[model samples]
Target chain A: MKPILECKGLGKSFGQKKAINNINLELERGKIIGLLGPNGSGKTTLLKLANNLLTPTAGEIRIAGFNPGPDTKQIVSYLPEKTYLNEWMRVKEIVEFFADFYRDFDPDKALTMLSQLGVDAKDRLKTLSKGTKEKVQLCLVMTREAKLYLLDEPIGGVDPAARDYILETIISNYHEDATVVISTHLIADIEQVLDYVIFLKDGQIALTSAVDKIREQEGKSVDSLFREVFKC
Target chain B: MGWDFETDRPIYIQIMEKIQLLILAGVYPVGAKLPSVRDLAQQAAVNPNTMQRALAQLEEEGLVITQRTSGRFVTENEEKIIQARRRLARDQVTQLLVKMRELGLGKEQILEIINEIAEEMKI
Candidate 1:
């Protein structure tokens, strides 16, 4: 089968700064992948190109064999680092908005998750605490039955409890045929859940390996490997 | 609940140990059916592929049996379970011995210490 996401010689630049350079990667189905890097290492840039938020300056990228346009967008569910929910709308209204916008969105699943997190459906987005808001956003994103889930720092800015819940939600919601790529610097928390990992370093592909292989061959966790690779 | 994995070792090895603990503890009783790979993955909050690899290791160890028509089942052999328990106890003693040697204690001294403690506890 064709890979769920493939990038061939993909490069992107912003003015004089290059965010991604000559990166080639192929992600297969049913694997949870970690895209790990430091702050300026182009992790988000690569994900943005994959989502078509930014066009590649060179080479090509494809999702399930299609360009990152409408067709690919249909199968790609993205949760950006920032909260994109409208503060004026209530939680149920936001759920309804997603239900109306995305063909694959499941309102019931979103509601169930929201209730589990103790989030009331009538509460305005702005009234909820920051962590709760993140959970709500994650709940919305995960309720969609998309082929590719691109989550940017899903555990960032949340408490450890929320981080555990978010990780559990991710593990439980993935379909057997879908692929999930999580971009985060918190390797220790996410390592056990990842099948494969990609390390981005200064706009380059530093390492691409399976988690178990890293453990067996390097005899160190991915977090330790990341620290060593990016250490000065 | 998510499985707690140690940082230094391969996760599959930890997973194998965890399953062995479960089997020895009678959580998955002898002859009991084990959960499907996907279900176990969800329960442990891990990737299905990772869970499948762990199950493969268990199957290789003969601690688990896979049926063609039905699903996987815990080994029905009581003797194998007892062997597994003894193997785990031996590993624990080996680790204890390594620590004792690090502390500059000889094997005979360690044995004498164990005897003293055993007498005190009357076991």
Candidate 2:
């Protein structure tokens, strides 16, 4: 089967600084993959390139065999690091907006998760706490029946309880055949749910392998290994 | 019940060990239906594919059986359960002996330590 996502000699740059370079990756289906790195490691750049928010200065990327465009966008559900919902809109209205915008969006699943997370649909976005707003955004993204989920820092700023809820929602929401790529600096929290991990460093691919393989061979968790590999 | 894992080893191995211990300890009684793979994965906070891999290993060992329409269940064979328990106990003893030997204790000293611990436990 064709890989869910592939990058060949992928490079991105801004002015004089290179953000990503020579990235060759092929992500398979049914895996929860972690795109891990510290700040300024191009994790977000790579994700944006994959999501078509930015064009690569060199090389190419493919999602489910299509280049990042209208075709791939339909199959890719993305959650940026920040909340994008308008503060004046009620949570229910945002759900309706998403349902209308994305053909794959499941309003029922979004509503169920929102209610379970104690998010009142009648409440405006500005009324919810910061973490609650993030939760609502995540709910909207996860409810889509997309083939690839690009979750950038899905659990970064939330409380531990909310983090767990987000991780569980991620695990249960996506189809088994679909791939979910989660980018975050927090490795220990999400390590168990990941099947594979990609470590980025200084605009290059540092390491990529199955999570169990790393554990068996290195005799350390990914977090420990990350510290060792990227110790500065 | 909570599942604690050592980070340096394969998760599927830990998951299999946990399920085996649960079976031998009667937490999942013989012939009892096991939870679905997804439910077990959620409970253990592990990936579903990893949980499935562990279940497949159990099936290979004949400690668990699956029905085409229904789900997995602990083996009904009492003798198999006893054998599994005995195998696990033997492995545990072997590991203990190896550790004791590494500490420079001969077989006689190991036996004495066991006796001392047993006596202390009886009180």
Second chain alone, TM-score for each candidate: 0.87, 0.92
Residue B40, candidate 2: alpha-carbon lDDT: 90
lDDT of 1 by residue, B7-33 (tens): 888998888899899999999999999
- For model 2, residues A16-47, the per-residue Cα lDDT tens digits are 89999889999999889999998999999999
- Candidate 1 per-residue C-alpha lDDT over A60-162 given as tens digits, one digit per residue, 9 for 90 to 100: 9999998998778889999987887899999999999999989999999999998987899999999999888988999999999999999998888788877
For TM-score, the strongest prediction is 1
Model 2 residue pairs with clashes: none
Candidate with maximal DockQ: 1
Tell me how each candidate scores on DockQ against the true complex. Answer: 0.74, 0.59
Candidate 2 to truth, TM: 0.93
Badly placed stretches (over 4 Å) of model 1 are: none
- CA RMSD of each candidate after superposition: 1.6, 2.1
lDDT (tens digit, per residue) of candidate 2 on B1-123: 226788888888899999999999999998999999988988888888889999999999999999989999999999989999999999999999989989999989888989999999994
Question: Runs in model 2 with CA error above 4 Å?
Answer: B98-123
Q: Report residue A226 deviation for candidate 2 (angstroms).
A: 0.8
